[model samples]
Target: MKPARPWFSAGPTAKRPGWSLAGLPTDLLGRGIRAPEVVERFAYALRLTREVLQVPDDYVACYLPASDTGAVEAALWAMLGQRPVQVVAFENFGLTWAADVRDHLKLDPEVIEAPWGELPDLSRVDPAKDVVFPWNGTTSGVRVPNADFISNEREGLSICDATSAAFAMPLDWPKLDVTTFSFQKALGGEAGIGVAVLSPRAVARLDTYRAPWPIPKVLRLQDGKGFDRALATGTMINTFSVMTIEDWIDALEWAQGIGGLETLIARTDANFAALSDWVERTDWIDFLAVRPEIRSTTSVCLKFTDPRVTGLPAEDQRAFVKRFKDLLEDEGAVFDMEPHRNAPPGLRLWCGCTVERADVEAATPWLDWAFGEALR
Candidate 1:
């Protein structure tokens, strides 16, 4: 039997298990962003963010434009260049940050990099240099197991691109200097906005140092006298959609109703367990992440392992992936299961909190059926 709801897109991902377009609040749809109630909604969203994510009391959480990409770029533009830098690139987004560091920022950072399925040697990266890395490798199904690599005593800050991990996994808040995430992923909220959390040290950096190049208003963190503290408290740096804010509030309310982070992580883990059980039973497929410990529970990427499939030429392998996913789509067994364009030709299944474990269990047989059909 096919799963009733088959949304598996990694981003702008599956909505909450019971979500309905008609259920989204529209009372403030066309209201001004700065109107008192709209502003309060924004503040409430931030508060819910901190409470549900268990963000540290001292860190300042602010809303920014352009989703997770904007939040990461804003941090890069506003905070880097005060000292030496390092980038741990194991996936596309991290690599993009590395590019910005080298090509755009024009800074020769110590680039600690690895291929898609592996992580860079954390021990090799200098602790005293400002470092940037993704907590969860959204594209490759690899993730840092924990913050054990971060040192408590270090001169520089830890900038984390936590876009995909925020609500699904535990974040070691104290060790992270600047952390950013999109509500679209883990929370199943609308896109086009992101939340950035700044440790006191990061805010101090904003107040003390200035970027050599002119920072765009959207990316700028501070002015001459002091940091833009108002943004930290709920003021947005740019015009925002109140309708999106309501959607965010809806998601946050659902998260809170379910008993918060522990529940969210449990839900994600349950979905992961269902899919992993299927993978173990199937001989033709295996996780893309080489190490079991680092395998992502959210975006579970897989590659075919059968000799005949693996023996296919690179282009053919890609074509096979397309045909397989297309078959599933046509059958309504899955949607958006194709690997990222930059990632290796494989399958990337979303097992995020919003996904029900039963759906994942119901969907795995489709992968087997599609593989056989595509082979024929």
Candidate 2:
């Protein structure tokens, strides 16, 4: 039988168990942005974010526009170039951040890179140089296994794009200076907003250092004075959707009510374990991240190992993967399971907090069936 709940998108995944449009708070709708009630709504979301993520009290979680990319860009443009910056690129989004530093920001960074499914030799990273990397390789399904490579006494900053890691993983906040993510990913919330948790060192960088370039108003967060406390504390410098904020608040409430961070992590772990067990028993599929430890527990990516498809030319391989995607999609047994445009021919599934373990287990049989029919 087809899966009971068949969604597997890597982002904007299935909503919480009892989520409903009517259940979301709507009293703040049509209220003024700076009004006390609306401000309280945003403040409540921020409080739950810090509590759910277990972020340190000193770090400021600022809500920014443009989603995860926006939060990353704000830090890159405003704080990079003060010292030697090292950009670590592995997956697509990691490569995107590296590009922003190299091409867009026009800075020559010490780039540490690896192929899509592998991580770089992180031990080679300089302790004294400012560094940037992703906590999770969203598209490639690789993640930094730990933060032991980062030095606790480094003089430079550590900027991490944690867009796909926040709700599902444990982060070493002390080792990180700037971290960015969105509620849209693991929490199944609305898109278009990003939250950045900045360390005291990161705030100091903003206050003391200059970017040597013109900063846009939308991305700008600091001035000659210091960090913008108003924005960092949930006040919007730009016009924002109250609907989005309400959705974010609702997601956090769901997460908190379900036992907070540990429960969220446990749910994702169960989902990943269910999916991983299938990949192990199946003969035709294998994880893209060969190193099991570094394999993402949230965005689990896999490639077909069957020679029927793998032996084809590169373009033909892509065509066959597309066929597999279409076969499953047409069956309504899966959705958004195709590999990203920049990734190799493969399947990506969301095993996040919002996804039930049984749903992931249910998907495996359909996946095998789809692959067999596609081969036929």
Candidate 3:
């Protein structure tokens, strides 16, 4: 039987169990975000975020406009020109950032790229130059295995896009200068807002260095000379949705109630383990990420390795995926399990903390059924 709710989408993922509109603070609905009541709630949300993520004491967590993309672009536009940049691109989002630096920023960055399901060689990264890479590749299901590759004695900063890995995986705060994620990812909160955590070094860069290009008002994190400290205190650059703020707070509270980050990680580990056990027994499918250490626990990408399926043309393979996914959806067994268009034709199921282990266990048999049906 299908779970009560079938939501395995990657972004804007399933909300916390037992979530409802009634739980939101209705009194704060009509009030302005800058109003005292709403501001206090927003501030509390930031505090909860810090506590839940266990961010460092010197780090500043700020709410920014747009989802992870906004926070990422703001950091790039504000801080890329300080030194030579090394960009690691393995998947779509990372490639997008590289394109921004090469085409939009018009900077001659040294870009290192790897094919899908693999990571760039981290040992070759130049620590003397500023570096940007996604800690976890949501599209490819590969992640940086560890932060040991980063040099402690480096002169330049490390800017990490950790949208999918923020709450699910452990982050090395000391190794990262700038890290960005959205409430919509692992937290399963409402979208439209991003959270940027900056270290003291990143703040100093903002205070001392300026990008050569023009900075828009919305993306500016500093005044003429000094960093805008208010942005870290729930003061957004543009108008934001108060309801979304409330939902984020609710999600944080739910995380706390469920034993904080450790519990969340454990939940995801169990879900991934369940799927891995199923995959080990199932011969037709296998992990897209070739290396076990780099495989993502949250966004689990699987590829069809069955000779019958692999023998088909590219278009037929895509058709197989569509048919398989459609059959699952039609049975109300699952939804939003389709791989990204640019990704290989397969399945990408979100195994984040919001997902239950039992659901993953139950869904495996359904996946087998769908695959068998599609083959027929």
Candidate 4:
């Protein structure tokens, strides 16, 4: 039988195997945000996050409001003016940040962009400019193959939106100055909260440099003259959902139980391998990310290359995606496997750590069936 709920949404992906609402902590449901027990659980989540991600001791990991969007904006609002900025965009989210820099922050940053499923020229990045880009383009399924493209002797900082890459892929902490992700991604936790990890250099930037514009209270890491150490130590800027915090703790514990980061990455890698094996034998489909090295193991995206589908107009191609996905959903074979609304017409499957390899394996044959049915 097919899995009961094959949640393949890019964010809020499948929960860890054997997870249920019954496993959550009940005592903290109605407690105040500053309750002693609540505070400890929040801190524990931070500690477990550090351990699971193997963050450097010199870095600080903190919870922030508004998911990954807030975290990225916070970094932008706090740090963009200290140096000239370079915004690298390969997909929608990257483009969003670039727009934020150019239009919102009004920084007039140098923009480096590429078509979907490709990467910008890394050599074009200047060390004197603060660099902003997504480590993994969730919509495009293209990831930076490695940190080698970044200069070790560079004077500028690397601020990465790692919403989809954090737990499922290996991150070189020494190479990233500010990295942000939401728990809803790889960990399969509840949404509305984001995790931001800052290197010592980033902390120094916050303490020393200030943006020329007014920083909102929610986005401020430092007051006019002093840094707010409390934000890094679990005193959040606003009231966050404590139940969501508990859910995140549950997810982190689940990650630790499964042998931590290496195990999580292996699971994602295995799932992607299973899907790739099937894709290789299937003639009608191909990866959106043409390069094997940069293909995302998390949001694995694919395009239908067969003439029957590609021959159609863009609108009809989108309809084909909807019909195919609907067939899978109707059969209970899959769920939320649709490509991102702004992405090119294709299928975007979540092969994150929380997803079971057996389920992915089972779903591939059904995909073949659905494709045939949709063409009819």
Query: Against the hidden reference, what TM-scores do the models get?
Result: 0.98, 0.98, 0.98, 0.98
lDDT of candidates 1 onward, in order: 0.90, 0.89, 0.91, 0.89
* Per-residue lDDT of candidate 4, residues 1-376 (tens digit): 6755578899888888888888887988888888898888888888889999999988998777899999999999988787899988998999999999989888898889999888888889888789998999999999999887678887899999999999999998888999999989998988899988998888889888878898887787886665677777787888888888888888888888989999999999999999999989999999999789989999998988899999999999999999999999998899998999999998999999999999888888888999999999
Q: What does candidate 3's lDDT look like per residue over 189-241, in tens digits? A: 88889889999989999999878889888788887666789988877788888
- Which digits, one per residue and each the tens of the lDDT, describe model 1 over residues 66-127? 99999999999988998899999999888999999999989999889898889889887677
**Candidate 2 residue spans exceeding 4 A from truth:** none
Among residues 3 or more apart in sequence or in different chains, the pairs in candidate 4 whose N, CA or C atoms overlap within 3 Å are none
RMSD of each: 1.0, 1.1, 1.0, 1.1
Q: Where in model 4 is the C-alpha error above 4 Å? A: none
Question: Which pairs of residues collide in model 3?
Answer: none
- Candidate 2 per-residue lDDT, tens place, 110-179, comes to 8899998899999988888999999999899999999999999999999999989998999999999999
Which candidate should be chosen as best, given lDDT against the real structure?
3
Off by over 4 Å in 1: none
**Candidates, ranked, lDDT:** 3, 1, 4, 2
In candidate 2, the residue pairs with backbone N, CA or C atoms under 3 Å apart (3 or more residues apart, or in different chains) clash, namely: none
Q: Give the Cα error of residue 147 in candidate 3, in Å.
A: 0.6
The deviation in Å at residue 80 for candidate 3 is 0.5
